[model samples]
Structure formats: C-alpha cells, structure tokens
Target: MLLETHVLQDTDPDLPALLADGFEVVGESWGAEFVIDGGAESTASLERLRGFVETARAAGLEIRELDARDAAAIESLDAESWVDVPTTPATVHVPVSALDVRDWATRGRRAFGALDGDRLVGLCVGAAGDNDFVVVAPDQRGRGIGGAVVAAWMLGAIEAGERSFSAGGALQNARSLAMIRAVGFRVTERWLSLQRP
Candidate 1:
C-alpha cells in the first residue's frame, strides 16, 4: 500500500512537531493542497500578473473565456501541458478528459484558454464555487502564459459575481506556488502526510 501527504508553505516558518516524528520525511510528504483566496483585493502582485498577461496578449497570445462543456475546446487541452509543469517526481499528474470537463460544466464552472494563433497554448477552469485549475503548454512554460490564463479566469469569475476563490497545488511545485501567490493568494493552512506501517 502507498500513502501520500502535503506540507503547506505557511508551515515553512517553523517545522511542525509531527514532521520530527518517525515518518521518514519521504522528501516532503504529500497530502493536502494550498488554498488561495481569490476574492483578495487588487494588490501589487495581482496588478503585476495582470500586466504580464496583457503584455503577452499584446504579443499575440489570445486569452478567451471558455465554456467547459465545449467538446472541441475540451479536446484541445494538451496532454503534454500537464507533464510540462515543473513538479517533484513524486507529484502525480492526472490526465484531463473531455468527460471530466463536461463534469466541470455540470458543476457550473467556466473554462479559459490561451491561444497562439490556432494553437491552444494554455487552459484553465473556474468553478462557480471559486476553485480553479490551470495548465500551460510545454513550450510556453515560464513565459507567464499560465498566469495569464489564471488571471483571465479570475476576471471572468469576478464578472460572474464570484467574490471568493481558491485553488490547490502540490507544495513541491514552487513555480506554480509562486504564480499563485503572484496573483495575490496567501497560504492559509498546512497539512502533513504520514504513512502507517
């Protein structure tokens, strides 16, 4: 049997007592995920990310709000994008199927995508409940395309009257964690994963 756990960024200030136990560390246990506060007021970080996305758009990357139920658009979510995100080898990457996206729509969620001409360079979904998931093309990593897609999603959610939002990601995924914070999300909790003998 296999077990997983997570330690959030907030707990980095002081290692929790549980972490000192005989849990074998396992190179950062994996369990819970980071929760983001999307309803956060506009801050310098949010403004900066928005500016970055706009600049990228000016350079020809088009950002558009997507209907999660669109079969063709859901089919466009690239499999390669998921593997491209820099994450610990321990991170589990799941495939997104069109049926999964249809489920997103059933939950009243909206999706967004970034296009470079006719190519789908990035994609994300915003739940009416304020949860979000974002992905960017392999060739487009570190270029703020993911951030752009997420920012666009947030804006659309705001228009739809969503006053609060949150998302989860592995703690080992620093790049993504940075992007989430760059958009004004603060870490709110820490979880520790422990395996039983």
Candidate 2:
C-alpha cells in the first residue's frame, strides 16, 4: 500500500510516529514549492534569466503569450519534455493523452511559448494559483530557452494581477530548482512523502 501526507514544515509534525507505523519517507526535498511574489526576484536569478532573454533574442527566438490555437504545439512540447526528464529506476513512463493536451491548452490558461520562425521550441504552463512548469525542446537546452521562457511567463502573470506564484519538482531536478529560485522563490517547505512497507 502507498500513502502520502503533505504538511507544512513549520508545523513540526511527528515524523517518528509515522516511521514507527511502517511508513518511510519515499521522497523529500528542499524548496519543493517556491512562492513567486509578484515580480520580485533575487537579484542574482533575475540577472541570469535576463541574460538568457538577451541571448535568445540575439538568436532570433521570440517569446509570446499562447492561446488555444497553440494547444497542439504545447501538447507536443509536453510529450517531448516528459520523455527527456532524467530517468532513473524509479521513473515511470506516463503517456500523454488527448485529455492531457486539452487540459494544457484550455482557454484562459495563462501560458507562453517560444518560437523560432513559427516553430514552437519551448513552453511555460501555469497552474491555477500555483507554480508553473517550463519545458524547452531537447535541441534547445543550454541556449537559455528555459530560463527566458520562464522570465517572460512571470512577467505576463504579473501583468494579469497574479501577485503570488509557486513551483514544485523532484528534489534531484537541479535545473528547475535553480530556475525557480532565480525567480525569487525561497524554500518555504520540504515535504516528506511516506509509503507503507
């Protein structure tokens, strides 16, 4: 059997009791959820992301807000991004379905896409009142596409009157953690997901 519990780190919950009850921390990480306060960001991360923006522009990559019409492209990017997630023995291949595409492309969902002459190369999908996920095409890595896309998305979100933002990912995902932190999301909580033996 598998069970999971999400609690605020500040609450000082009883972890020993859970362990004694045959529960083990299957996963735990720092800064799993980062809160983005309006457009406020760490000076360091801001500089980094901005640098990426300039670099991408020089490379002829354009960033823009996306709509329903770009859904298919976003879905394709999603599948490609998922397939490239650093895999391990614990990884699972969850197929992306049509429903998933529709959900990602739903109207009014605040999203952004990066284009190189009309070809979608990156995407930033925002969660309702939550942290958003960013994906850049495999060939697009190291070109600052991921960071630039995120920076643009955050600007758009701020303009839409969203004052708070948060993001979460696996503990081992350093690239994402750095990107989010660069956007000024401090580590507020570390969640311990427990499972039965």
Whole-model Cα lDDT of every candidate shown, in order: 0.64, 0.65
Worst 10 residues of 1 by lDDT: 27-36
Best by TM-score: 2
TM-score of each predicted structure versus truth: 0.73, 0.74
Q: After TM-score superposition, what is the CA distance of residue 22 in candidate 1 from its true location, in Å?
A: 2.9
Candidate 1, overall lDDT?
0.64
Cα deviation of 148 in candidate 1 (Å)?
A: 0.7
**Residue-by-residue lDDT tens digits, candidate 2, 116-165:** 99788987777554645678788877777777787777667655676566
Q: Residue by residue across 138-164, what tens digits does model 1's lDDT show?
A: 677888887788778777766676656
Which candidate leads in lDDT?
2
Q: Candidate 1 has which clashing residue pairs, if any?
A: 4-30, 5-29, 5-30, 5-31, 5-193, 6-30, 6-31
